[model samples]
Structure formats: C-alpha cells, structure tokens
Target: MIMPRGSDQLLLPVNPFFIALTLLLAFAFMLLPFGRHPALPDLLAVVLVFWTVHQPRRVGVGLGFCFGLLLDVHQGALLGQHALAYSLLAYAAISAHRRLLWFGVVEQALQIAPLFFAAHLVSLLVGLAAGGMFPGWWMFLAPVIEALAWPLVTIALLAPQRRAPDPDENRPL
Candidate 1:
C-alpha cells in the first residue's frame, strides 16, 4: 500500500509498558500543585488523546474513563465531569485516527484542536450545570495550550518508536 505523504516512515511497534508509563506520568503531572490556573493545559488530556489516536486498539475509551475518574477524585470535582469529557475526547480521537495519521504533526495538532476544545467545553458545561463558579476567561486558554502542546508531545512520545531497532551501516530505514 502507498503510504501517505505526511507519514514519514514506519514506526516500531509501540511498547505497552511505555504507554502505561506515559499515562501515569501525565497523571502525576496533574497531581502537582499548579494552583488551579484556568489556563493550565491538561497534560493528561493531551497525552490521552495522543495515545488514543496512535494506538486506538490498546488505548481507548475505557482507559480514558478510568483516568478521568481518577482525575475527578483527585480534584474533588463533579463525579463524572472529566470522565464524560475524556471519554468523548477518546471517542473523537479514535474516530479520526485513520485520517489524523495522514497529516504532519503540526497539521495533526491543528486538526485535534477542536477535539481538545470540545472536551474543555464539555468539562466547563458540566461544571456550570453543577453550580460551580466560572473559572473566568482564562479557561479558554487551556485548550489552545493543549493544542500548542500537541507537536511537542507527539515528538517526545514518538521518539522511542523512531529509533532503529537493528542499526546497521547499510540499513537506512
């Protein structure tokens, strides 16, 4: 099959342990005392979406739900707020996974911007419906920051997969 122009090369099979480690690391990042800044990007969401898109079969809605619940418990927010948002985010990423892979990292970032925005929107709406105070205009910045983070996260996460498994002078794959 002819590969898409945007897909530069084949990737090594993803390691399951690496995926779990990244997810756990993102979760740990969320647990940091960031003072609840409204514009703070959701590193967990960004990482979740990346894995959902890249490894749909391995990382899907269920994982998103579980992590979202954990985040909810951590933040003491409405029970299913992040769960609903993340599940939807994962679903959207999985739905667009095939087409999303055909774009360069930057373009892929732009494409997923709406998904991140929508997830934030869902979270905001849920919070509002629960009578939570508005987090102010800064709330909108999170999704943009998350979108901006896409390329960096993509590059970092894909680094391990980019290395040649069996390097040889004559093999330039």
Candidate 2:
C-alpha cells in the first residue's frame, strides 16, 4: 500500500511535454488579440494553478517566474510584473497542495480561484506600483472568468496523464 499522504506519495508522473504544451498553448491564448473588453484570461496562471496542485515539483516558482517574464516580453507588459505574480502563485500552490487534493474538483476549483485572482491582482498591483497606468476595474474581470475556467483547465492540464488511478493504492480520505 502507498504510505499516508506526503510528498513521497506516488504522484501521477507529469511529462515535460505536458508542461511545454500547456505553456505554449497558454501563451498562444494570450497572444491572440482580445475582443473589446480590454481583458484577457489568465491562461498561464490557470496552468500554474493546475500543475502546482497536481504536481508541485514539476511546476514551480522558477518555472512560473520565467513564464511570467516570458509573458512580459510577449505581451508588452512590465518585465517583472508577471514574474512576481507567477512566483507567488507557485509558492502558494506548493504550500497548499497537500490540503487541496483532499477536496473534490469543485472545491479545489474554488480554492484555486483566489490564487488565480491573486496572481493577476499582484500583477496589476505591481504594474500600478511601477508607475504603469491602472487598468480599468474590468481588468479584474479576467479572474472571474479564470475561476470559472478552472475545472476545464484542470482537465486540460491533467489530460496528459489520464491513466486510471492505481487500484491498489489507497485513496485520500
């Protein structure tokens, strides 16, 4: 039997391609010009929240930070804004990950919603702090959409490793 819950527990192995593909897809989603709302979904943040919960070691602060900075270059946002938000979100994910797995998909989505919101909030906060003009209150709208999108994001993120759960191993309480 697998040992009680811990980092040592057998995690579903997440392939590097999973990470790369998700990030690339997320980048593309962001790069596509927005409609008329002046709001863009937090695609990278959604992916980070997913991996952080499902596979903390595979998706982490450095990855989040780099992705954020890369986003900065791609989207023409401030250089460090996304980097800080992503790193913070990663740290939060690792710390809360153990508790999150116990919750149902809906519950987990509720939990990560704020992390998604906060990551973007931090980005906006940093932008304002850095002398960038404050985006409209509508900028906050993306998080709401992001939170609603979490379930799909989780499925998309985990689809790469969708083997049935190990029958022999104990399920979480």
Candidate 3:
C-alpha cells in the first residue's frame, strides 16, 4: 500500500521518460506468448488508465489513440478497434480523475473496473462491426484481472515519486 504523502512533503517529480519506458515495457509484456490465453490482464491498458488518471496532461486521448493504433498494428487486429477503446478509456479516466484521487489505490481499482470493462466492450463491438468474430467470453475477464492488478501498478509506479525518509533525522550519533 502506498502511504499518502502530506501536502507539505517534497517528493521527486515524475519524469516523462520513465512513463514512456514503462508503457513500452507493458507493450513488450503483452507480446510475450502466454499460450494463447484471453484472460491475461492487459498491462498496457492498466498503465494507460494509471497515467490518464494520475497525469491527464501527459497521457491523454492523443497518446491513447496512438498507443491503440500501435497495438492494433502489432496484434494484426482491425484498425481503430483498439484506438477507439483506448481513447474511450482515456476519456473516462480524465473524466474521473479528480474523484479517483480522493480514494485509496484499492478503492480506485473497484471504481476503475468499469472503465476497463467498458474499454474491452468497445473493442469487441468495433471488431464485431468490422465483421470480425467474437473473441469469446474470456475476453471479458481481462478487465477484471486488470482492475485487480491496479493497486500493484499504482504502488510500483508511485515508488519513484515517494519521498524517502531523511537519514539524518533518525541518527543519534
């Protein structure tokens, strides 16, 4: 659990480079052959949601659209399917950002579950409209997994932003 820092605390600012790197890593993780399972958490989507909620200016609809396009191309799926889904998720995150900030990471996950689920539904619907076959019921489970993993993602990503304890404050020498 990430302890909330006081408003007076001075923590390190988030670097755009690290955000991009983590997103890239998430994409690479998605490419790993997981034995054709559809229930795997979409790590990229999780990261997207994380940034969109926490840093709207850095990770907005434009970035989401671009990332979705890349994923579509990489996965050989219908173009605009993921684009629409990701953009929708970004929009939802931006809309809910303020509210999410008031909650803890675990509670935030519960609220975020619907966004992930809705994003998947948008993708599925777009694919269907494009004459693609249904991806099966397991696809729905992806959001749940992603939502459940939200707290972990939050903790990992926020580690760099957390203020370290001052070493000299505890010294008795």
Candidate 4:
C-alpha cells in the first residue's frame, strides 16, 4: 500500500474510551458559563466531527444526536435543534472522511470549515423556525472559530495514537 505524500504514518487503533472521554470533556466545556455568546466556538461539535471523520464506525450520527440532545436539555434550547444539526454534521463528516484524510491538517481544516458552517446554519434555521430571535451576525463567528481550532484539536486528539506501538530503538515506523 503506497502511502500518499500528504498522509501521516499509520495511527494506532483508536481507543473507544478515549473517544468517549474527549466527547464528554467537550460537552462539559459547552456546559460552562459561556453566557450564550453567539461567537463562542462549539468545542463539542468540533470533537464530534473529528471523531466521526476519524472513527466513523465507532462515533456516528447516533452519538452526535445523543450529545446534542443532552446539550439541548442543558441549554434549554429547542428540543431537537442541536440534535438535527449534529446528526447532519456527523453524516457529512462521515461522508467526507475518506477524501478528507488525503489532505494535510491545514487543508483538512479548510475542507471542514463548510461542515461547521452548515451545522451552525442548521441550528440557526431551526431556532428561527421555532420563534427564536436571530442571534445576530456574530453567530457566524462560532463556525469560523471552530474551523480554526480544528488543527489544534486534531493534534491533541491524535497525539496518543501517534506514538509507536513497540517503541523499539532501531524499528522506526
């Protein structure tokens, strides 16, 4: 199997527990007292999308839906608003996963920007349809910030898997 020029070395199999832990941590971050600022990034969305792309079989639309529901309950927003947005986001990420992996991290971030925007747009539209007031143009900033955080999140999340499995001195993988 000839590796692509832009691709990194093979990653270790992702641990399910780590995936869950990261998702929960992101959700907890979301629950913090961020004061409902429209411009605030959705860390959960970014992590969810990351896992969905990198481990689609393990973390798919169902997890996204469940977490989104949890967020809705916590935030007191329209019941299915986040759920719908996250489901669509996960689906999109899964669909793009293969093609996305061929790019460098920065290019991957550029490609993912639209998915974040679409998720936010879905949430915004759902809110508007539910008689919620528009959150102003600043709302768009959330997706941009989320996109910007993609590389950092990718590095942090993939760090554990990047280590050599055996770490033999002469066996450079």
Least well predicted 10-residue stretch by lDDT in candidate 4: 1-10
Model 3 score (lDDT) = 0.87
The lDDT of each candidate is 0.95, 0.79, 0.87, 0.95
Write model 4 residue lDDT over 87-156, tens digit each, in one string: 9999999999999988888999999999999999999999999999999999999999999999999999
Q: What is the lDDT of candidate 4?
A: 0.95
What is the lDDT for 169 in model 2? Answer: 52
In terms of TM-score, how similar is model 1 to the real structure? 0.95
lDDT of 2 at 127: 83
CA deviation > 4 Å runs, candidate 2: 1-12, 35-38, 164-173
Per-model TM-score, in order, reads 0.95, 0.81, 0.88, 0.95
Error of 4 at 1 (Å): 7.0
Candidate 1 structure quality by residue, lDDT tens digits, 1-173: 76776757778999999999999999999999989889999999999999999999999999999999999999999999999999999999999999999888899989999999999999999999999999999989989999999999999999999999999987655
Backbone clashes in model 4: 0
For residues 32-139, what per-residue lDDT tens digits would candidate 3 score against the true structure? 877556677789999998999888989999999998999899888898888899999999999999999889888999999999999988888888888988868998
Q: List the residue pairs that clash in candidate 4.
A: none
- Candidate 2 residue 149 Cα shift, in angstroms, is 0.7
- Write down the worst ten-residue block by lDDT for model 3: 1-10
